[model samples]
Each structure stands twice: as structure tokens, then as C-alpha cells.
Target: MTDPITIQWTPKTGLPRRLTFEPLEKGYRRIEREWNGSEWRHCGSEHTTDLTLHPPEDPPTLEELISQIHGTWDHPNPAVLTFTNEDTVAEINGQLRYRSPTQDGWYAVTKTDLESHLRTAGYPTIHRLSETPYNRADFTADSIPRQ
Candidate 1:
């Protein structure tokens, strides 16, 4: 097996950031990040040992991982700017209306927006649920009842 992938970033200021990607059971991989700070503080995912891993195969590239860390993950939220697939720039009646779905009716978000809502929620890192390992039919009939 290959050694865990480690990425290091040194900003102009502040401590350096290091990310380590480790393989997990069931063909999954987990990522852990630490800030080169006093006592080597961890930046996110408090439960170090319990941190879930990402799948080993098809792991996100370094650029993708950096984007995610920089608050540009694919998930959408109103606080951050996000563009959806249906967004278009058009002059409607001469007034520019950047419109799309709003989180709380306060603002609009496009389908193609690329901002992270994690900061707004006060989280150092954002996590999203991966696709289920099995489909509903894969389970026994008695395992789950119809809603």
C-alpha cells in the first residue's frame, strides 16, 4: 500500500497548513488537517480518531481539495455566492437581476456559485454526505418500510 498523501501550504502570514490523507477500511480514505500552531493545533474535525475517511479510489485532486478547504465546495448555501446550472446573465428590462434560489428569501444564489457556507456556520471545515453504499432495494424487505 502507498503511504498517505500529505499536502502542505504556507501562507504569506500565519502558520502553515498541512493535510494528510489516510486510507480507511472498506476502501475509503480519511483526511486530517493540522495547523502548525502552538502545540500543533488541529483546525477541524474535533474527533480526530473518529474522523470519517474518503474513499481511496478516485480521491479528489490537490486542486479540488484546496478549493474545498478555501470554502468553494460544491454544496450550496445563501450566505456564500454559488451559481447553479440554470443561471444566465441577461438584461431584463435594463435592470440587472442576479436571481436564483434564496436560502431565507433574503438573497438569491445562482447555480454556478462557488462559495462555501461553512464560515458562516462557524465551522473550520465543511463535510458532505457521500452517496449511500447500497440502494434501498439492496436491503431486505423487512429492513426498511415504505415511507
Candidate 2:
């Protein structure tokens, strides 16, 4: 069976709405939800015994994933903090010193930190994707620190 897909769009007269198609054992289920300015509210759902739907024949390549990520334009601008060996902490131009528990006044918050928090809060998956192009070495521990 194919993975669930959700398509979102905003109507000309109403709030934004999204339709999600989830694959089930018997068939598929379609769930409709609308954004009510605060949260998504379920509108309705329908099930059909359609098992002909399938995923793409070929899996998406790494290049395709990277290209799709760069094509998107709605990413948030996160605040980056830089940590020094001393107690003094300051925000970088854009935007850790790991000490004892008591000495830990402020440490740099990495992307891994935010992703871990979201996952712990019941989020399904958190991807460590970069806004700009990057290589494998960019994620290595010995790589240059991002500014």
C-alpha cells in the first residue's frame, strides 16, 4: 500500500483546508480538516474499497529530496546562539560549552536539540535539513561551526 498523503490548500472564501488520504487494510480513508485560525478541526471522513492506488515505482533519490527542500520557501528563521568557554553568552550575527550541571549557565542550542524536543513531545519525525545546500561533512562533528 502507499503511504498517507495530505494535500493542503486555501479556498478563496474560506479558511485553509487539508485532505488526508490514509491507507487502510480494507481500503482507504479520506479525512477532511479545516484550519480554524488556531488548530485543525475535523470536518468529515469517508472510506472506499479502492486498493488500486500505489506509490511511485521508484523511490525518491537523495538529490530529489535535496532539490525539493531547497525549492520550498516557508522555513522559519531560527535564532542562533553562540557559546564561549566563559560564562558570557551572546547571540551570533544571525542567530556550547558543556560544563557541570551547576556550571551550565548557557550552552549553544543545536538543531539536534530542537529536533529531539519535538520528537519527545510526540512528533512523528524531525528531519535535520539545511536551508542551503550542504554536503555530508557539514553534519560531521569536526566540521566548522555554523555562524
Candidate 3:
């Protein structure tokens, strides 16, 4: 049996779904799953012999990305960033921090800095989910888990 090909997507509900194509005897079995916080739950499945998968569509919009930004994975004190209706305002660790320039490797970042820089900045060498993976969070910095 050949290895399965898995595809992932995040919908309007903010929950992530995964579609896996597993090679079968004369066809492929497609398994659909949704992420329920800590695990992936099966939603549905099907079998197809003739199926052509297409490339994924456009990336998530800035608004979508911003909305997904929440609790920090490696934060010591379980920091969370809550965005208000005002674009320039955000509460970090329950303290309101206004729009401002955040230096590299800093823990606190303003909403403006996140939208303008963090989104496009180079990813740290670390896996962003695992410790001792590769890069150090202290030098590069950790990120919220989305993918």
C-alpha cells in the first residue's frame, strides 16, 4: 500500500479539517476529520477510484490570520492576546498595550506590529510546537500554534 496524502483546511468556524487520501486495492479511501481542540475527530469518509486532487487555493486572509492569533504555546504565564473592535488596541496578559513598535524577540507586541511585521516575518527555526526541536525560542522566538 502506498502512503496516504493528507490535506488540511481551516473554515469559517475557525476549526481545522483534514482530508486524507489512502491508497486502497483498486481505489482510494478519503477520510475527513475535524480538529476538536486537542484531537482530530472523524467526520466522514468515501471511496473513489478516479479522483484528481487540485492544488490548494489562496492563503488565509489577514483578517482570518489575525483572528486566529490567541494564546501562546510557549508562554510561561499562559499569555493571551485579546483583540478589541479597535484595530490599534489589544490586551496582552490582561494588560492593554496600544499600538507601538515591538523589538525583535520581545514577548509583548502591539496589534499594529503583529499585523505589519509578525505575519510576514521569517519563522523561527523551532518547530513552534516542540521543545528542543531545532531553533531556540529565546533567540528566534516562539509562535502561536495555528497549523
The C-alpha lDDT values of all candidates are 0.34, 0.45, 0.50
lDDT of 2 by residue, 1-147 (tens): 789878899999999999888999877899999999999999999785543447547544433433333422234432111122111112232222111123313344433553453333322111322322322222222322335
C-alpha lDDT (0 to 100) for residue 76 of candidate 3: 49
Against the hidden reference, what TM-scores do the models get?
0.30, 0.33, 0.35
Q: lDDT order of candidates, best first?
A: 3, 2, 1
Best by TM-score: 3
lDDT of 3 by residue, 93-114 (tens): 4332322134233244444555
Q: Residue 15: error of model 3 in Å?
A: 0.7
Segments in model 1 whose C-alpha atoms lie over 4 Å from true places? 27-32, 35-38, 46-147
Model 3's lDDT to the true fold? 0.50
The candidate maximizing lDDT is 3
